[model samples]
Target chain A: MAGHFKQKSKAKQDIPTASLPDIIFMLLIFFMVTTVLRETTVQVRTILPKAEALTKIDQKRLVTYLWIGPKKLPDNAIGETGVQIDDALVEDLSSVRSIMYRKLVEQPKLIVSLRVDGTSEMGILMDVQQELREAGTLRVNFSTKRDVVL
Target chain B: MPVIKKKERVEPFIPTASMADIAFLLLIFFLVTTTIDVDTGIGMVLPPKLEEDVIPPPIKERNVLKILVNEQGQVLLEDLPSAVGLVRDQVKKHVLNNGVDPRYAEATDKALVSIKTARETPYDAYIQVLDEVWMAYFEMWDSEARQLGYANYRDYVAVVGQDNPIREKIKAAISIAEPDAA
Candidate 1:
């Protein structure tokens, strides 16, 4: 009996790691499904205005972002304020209509999200609005941070 | 001669011992790269562009509450200077006048909160103003729903969702005018 007990104590106790790969695969699948790779790299800096009574857009696929603010590089010869569509800078405001019209045609239920800087000139913002109106994408969302205290 | 013996080859197996490490690496990469920003904003439907400027129909003077945000970031209520903090209360009072005074909105249904922003006005100020107006309407609905036996605003909304007649009627009263080119 003493010899049997000594032999049992000498035997190595190994943790079961055979299912580790399977567990890892499950986690990988979960992350792949949930992770949304950022579609476009932001070329401009922006500080969204703060507000209350904000409504969130439920469907990510149905929204298009329009970033209007000073150029990310202030030292550039062109003025600081500029309109950026996706990753490219929009030089002419008039062209905004055609570009947005094409997007609207592509997705009829498209909701344009305006991510304008807090201190940006409203003239450019309004101009963008007029172009959106002409494009017939009348649904606009002025993206803002929630003012919790107020 | 003795029968020649054939050599049997052992099948090679791929090592998957580090599979968890690979998956963890990828998961950490995605975790670092992902930005879970939930988009929220004030939604507005703009009128279609016309070939010529069309003037809005005249609203009763009492029913209209004109809020102006100027280039200097100053807020004006009815062309008189006003602070941003008091806007919600002022709007609520006018909206809930309940036909008690001729100088205010004749009824909740008739109230119109018109917001006009200057071209140079800071975007922050403009959003703040709109937020206050929307808050006023929401507060009114909360109290009104409470009177109807609903516990609170959220409860009332849960009972009668956004598409109900009451919400539609109230939404019609809030209008945003074209921004002034100041």
Candidate 2:
């Protein structure tokens, strides 16, 4: 009985944690290598409507821009009825469609941000939406000003 | 003496726990790295431009449908006060009778239609008209081939009418606008 107690061999128990950290590091590297980056390339020209609740977007290109102003004329913004692309006049909505398609094709994931005048007719805005869908550039955001909170 | 004393039982090593940890780590890694998209409500198609025989037609008022909506929300089909209920009927009639006028045919060749809207008219009216036009096109396409009136599938007016009458209607409706309305 005395020999049995004395013969007990307490083997060294130091399970290596180095292997775990090595694995965690490798996983971190793999994720960093495989991560995809998103770009912001606007498909249309839009002047976001003035809003009482607007916040500044951190970047461009992630957003598409559209400006709706006077249609058919030399471009009088005070009273306009059509869309603008990068500030140039688009006489008709079809122009908007084709241009958007081209942009969407180039940048597979681009969000369109609309800066619309509050007074713009809903019909025209809907028309813009209809065109966007046909072109497959669906991402949309509205530009607004931050309201003064009382 | 023969062989040896009974061999002690041998235990095989198992790595179940390690494999599970590795898998879980990989799963979390992928979930955090994917990109997502935002969507817009409407779609658009841009027209293709060609330089060849692109000619502007000598468009006159008779060939044009001339839809005008004044600031007061009165809808005008060809300069006449048109009600929302009357839009489909009037447009349908005009489209069906399109072949009656040669100039209406000619004006459409240039792809012009004058939708003159006042500064204050609601934009919804225009969208409604556009929606109707698309619906009418679908109807014309479906009815022309006798897909709806099949006996098992049979037809007498097979290919009698020309395709795209709506395009003609749009063209004719566009001519002769009040140039300054824009």
Candidate 3:
């Protein structure tokens, strides 16, 4: 302290506080570089049927969506159980294999979640599931409408 | 000659933080480089395990009967059904005809419960159909007055004594799938 004061004769030098800022900057850079940014796209187009009893699924990072469209079911009524997807028509579930294979390659343990119209054909639904299983997507879930009182 | 007589002034002390900054930066860099694991989204309400959860009963894969529901909500057993009303009968017939000896998988105590149902089947209709199958199993057990032995199955039917009703037998159980879509 005496040495420092002895040289305080009308002269001053500034102490830098850049260390904390540098550390914070480095942390931001690290997260930006390593965090996994999942690319999510629905391989099949589907319109979710309206259910007063529908339940909202709560899953964020590890979810893969499979939509079951009403297309190809020749006997289906227009409004009976229509599902909506991005301005695209998904006529078949056979394409699920390729898409799932591509995604599963990235993460083998990924879980696939399906959202199908209530009135969709059981056959198609099962077919989709079978295809996923064949593609090694063993973890599966069905979204449902939890009856809510009017 | 006059300038040489003057003395020089020394600079005062000042603190520098260049090292601290570098250390902070390194710490942040490490914190960001770690990869995080994500959760799997599948959800299932599995049946609770018995006390002997890991008993590892049999190496045999039980025989399964498939019940399919087509787009029109028609129930198909082995690809055909005469009447929705007859579903239970058809299942019962299949279960009974499973050839009772070591030849028949189901009747020989190795039969699997009914097979899987498509996910898009009307939940109500599916539940109704499953209930009917269970009812059929009970009815078949009663009609034959059959009691299972501990050697083949753990279930021992209790004989009716005035107050106690005769316990019915259940065909061997099996698996149903959790469908991916509607």
Candidate 4:
């Protein structure tokens, strides 16, 4: 019995690391498949408002983002409200129609997600909406965080 | 040395000991950078641009439930001074009235909840009001789903899809009235 116990312990002492590579490779493949690299660095301060009526946009490819918020200044101070589409801040509001129209031409089923700051006034958002209407890309999403229940 | 040393045989084997180490390195890199946060928000389809000469189909006064948000974030439900919290119940009552009250909608399909906001109104306030209206519609759908022996509207939608008649029955007809040009 003592000899048998000794043999059992010896066999179990090495945790059998031969399959470690396979396991690790499996995990690596999973991470690689699921990885979505951050594309653009946002320049505005967009603190999205919290709400309950939230829907998940499963098809990430069909959605385009429109960031609206106060511009981040050099001295950590926020400047006037600005609208950003992908990389560049839209200098002229009228240009929004052309840019969105080009995007609509590319992806007909484009859903424009408005990531607006909570404190932003309705004026800028309305202007953006007008441009979107002109561009004929009418599907809009008001991006908001899930409101935590107490 | 006597008979050519019998031509010494050496077995060849590939080294796999470092394979796990390399995989672990890559795994750690991805683990550090992967962000699985999903994008969640309220989805709305904006009305298409109407032609200059085309006049929109006129909706009856009773069919529309107008909720206006002023610059002060104060809500005006049906042109009456009201709090934001009351919009949900008022919307539900208006939609489900079914011709019972002359001031409310004639039917569920005819009911249109229009949210009009002033240019100076905070975005959050508009969102709050919109959220309430959406919640009211969701609650109605939930009850409708329960009556159909389903768990909730989502479950029912999963089974029947978006184009089903039930969804068309209690369709959420919300209109975002454009603010006056500044």
How good is the docking of model 1, by CAPRI class?
A: medium
The TM-score measured for candidate 1 stands at: 0.85
Best by DockQ: 4
Q: How close to the true structure is residue B79 of candidate 4, measured as C-alpha lDDT?
A: 81
RMSD per model, one decimal: 4.3, 15.7, 16.1, 3.7
For the second chain of model 2, what is the TM-score against the true structure's chain B? 0.48
Residue-level lDDT for B147 in candidate 1: 78
Q: What is the lDDT of candidate 1?
A: 0.82
Candidate 4 lDDT over residue span A5-123, tens digit each: 88887765667889999999999999998998889878899999989988899888899999999999999999999999999899999999999999999999999999999999998
lDDT winner, 1 or 3:
1
- Per-residue CA lDDT of candidate 4, range B119-151, in tens? 889999999999999999989989999999999
B162 in model 3: Cα distance from truth in Å?
A: 43
lDDT of 1 by residue, A51-92 (tens): 878888988889999998877765643348878888888999
lDDT of each: 0.82, 0.52, 0.51, 0.92
lDDT, candidate 2, A1-150, per-residue tens = 887866664555678664675676577667666555443333333333322212244445566677664443235334456566665666788777899888888887766766555456755665776677778776655544443446
Weakest 10 consecutive residues of candidate 4 chain A by summed lDDT: A7-16
The per-residue C-alpha lDDT of model 3 at residue B118 equals 55
DockQ of each: 0.65, 0.07, 0.13, 0.75
Candidate 1 or 4, higher TM-score?
4
State residue A113's C-alpha deviation in candidate 1, in Å: 0.4
Give the Å shift of residue B22 in candidate 2.
10
